[model samples]
Target chain A: MKKRDHKECVSALLPVKDTLDLIGGKWKLLIIISIWEGNKHFREIERSIPKLSTKVLAKELKELEMNKLLHRNVIDDFPVRIEYTLTEHAKSLKTVIGTLHSWGLTHRKAIFEK
Target chain B: MKKRDHKECVSALLPVKDTLDLIGGKWKLLIIISIWEGNKHFREIERSIPKLSTKVLAKELKELEMNKLLHRNVIDDFPVRIEYTLTEHAKSLKTVIGTLHSWGLTHRKAIFEK
Candidate 1:
């Protein structure tokens, strides 16, 4: 098979870069996964991901919200409660995260059993 | 559906963390894709990725080789041609990268056309 040219490689890479730019960091995807798994509050999301501190979680949440991947809702109550949910756009990441989770699981076995 | 507890969440996130630790940087996947596309030599890989500096490419290649995600071969030629290839372990990432590529394409359209 003929090798892809430099131009083809770069074109294929650009969209992946866009995805990474939005959700590449160590904490971003973990937080997304946690929230997707039903950690609706800031503290709950924080506790779900190990070693993710309050400060970093707060920052990541803000970034996710800014990027429209997360929705921050304020519920009306005696004490107003804040909730976080994955936006419709963010739901588009289900397959990406699922694939990563499976690959990660297999990768762990591959690395350890060899 | 029952929400995953913190402990369960942490358990699930650990393998993902393991995978990320191995291949979670900005340029690592891009480099892998380039080599997989038959950019055998270092120069070819370097040229395939846009805006990637020689210094960063060199460093990323070293890390990938050390992680066993890449294999470097020195061909016995007049100039001792050096080549790069993705390892079997790295080939496991095809699904993960494919999912990301498709998600990214959709995401770009979602973000821009909205």
Candidate 2:
């Protein structure tokens, strides 16, 4: 890689707000994590996540697909089947989510209950 | 850590939306990353981040402090100075944010322009 300047490097970052803007919705991250468990079909994702209205689930899924974080493959059949997978980009979120999970554990014990 | 069951382990993870709920706002992660650069105090943080309205900065800082991600130590003196530092819990985010930065680079090259 070529040597990049400080300004160049900083500008290269995904704007933090844009990052959140893409994944910040109420269902985006959960939808990603739900698919993370290998459930892919719409009904499967809906079933895995309790109380998720179909409308919201569809909306979130389309958004995730648009952002390239999740892939929606439509299987041709009597009833179309859609399977979702984490893009390589979305896989990067695993580390982020893992750290968040760790923080949650620590926060639950130390901060939340207090 | 004790050997925990599947449900217990899963429950231990923060709800993904809640994680976003805490840090997924317009200014939260930027505020965190701004403070990540060793700039402390209301003024220094303000100066480091351009175009950030003071009201929003103050509000985000207070929220970050309440979440224990940032510390506000008021220095008792003539003018009374306050500084912010990332808590140890916040340090865990380094890996997560680093991964995000890397993904941004790759995404810019591979996906965003397409």
Candidate 3:
């Protein structure tokens, strides 16, 4: 293999890594899916993912918002409520992530079966 | 809204949560894509993801291997060499992830643009 060829290969992979960095995380995708499934508020998300700590969920939601995958709307109520929904760009990811879920169901073999 | 309806909604989301747990990680998808792009050996993988630390890449590879997303082949020579490839199940995820990459290109809005 040529030395220059190796550098090209690595360079090609940088975008893949960046994409992973955006969507891959312990709670980010769960938050996205939860929002997709109709959880609009922080409490609703917390309710849906029972095992996720509040701090973790908050952090994940912030990251997703930072990544532009979610829209956070703060409703000015007595307690100050926040609602999260998918942005148009994030809405676009629905098909892809949904396909991933389908792949898990139909194609995920027993190797990682819990 | 009824309490039972809320419970049903949460239950419907459990599978999505589980699926997220599988592929959502800083390195997993990148590593999978790297393997798809044709690096098979440990050193080759290391070379492909230049920004990834050796330890982190090794750990991610092992996790993928454990999840049956990657097949690790050991070549017993003077210095035993290991090669990794996607399993059939993992291969099935290609279309989904590729679609995701395309989605990022065509549909990802400017909210998260660099």
Worst 10 residues of 3 chain B by lDDT: B1-10
Clashes of each: 0, 0, 0
Candidate 2 local lDDT, A1-114, one digit each (tens):
632334633641345444566666557777788888778888988877766899999898888888888888888987777778899878777766776666555454454445
Which docking category, incorrect, acceptable, medium or high, applies to candidate 3? acceptable
Name the better of 1 and 2 by lDDT.
1
Look at candidate 2 and tell me the lDDT of residue B26: 64
Cα lDDT of model 3 by residue, B38-108, tens digit: 88887777766657789998788877777778888898997988888888777777677776676644543
lDDT of 1 by residue, A1-114 (tens): 332233434555767777888888888888887887778998898877778899999999999988889899999896999999999888888788777877777776666556
**Tens-digit lDDT track of model 1 for B1-114:** 332233434445666677787778789888988888778988888888888999999999999998889888989989789988888999999988888888787786566556
The residue ranges of model 1 lying beyond 4 angstroms of the native Cα positions read A1-11, B1-11
Q: How much does each candidate deviate at the interface, measured as C-alpha RMSD after superposition?
A: 1.7, 3.3, 2.8
Quality of candidate 3 docking, DockQ: 0.44
* DockQ of every predicted complex: 0.55, 0.37, 0.44
lDDT, each prediction: 0.81, 0.69, 0.70
Pairs of residues clashing in candidate 3: none
Give me the candidate number with maximum TM-score.
1
- Which candidate would rank higher by TM-score, 1 or 2? 1
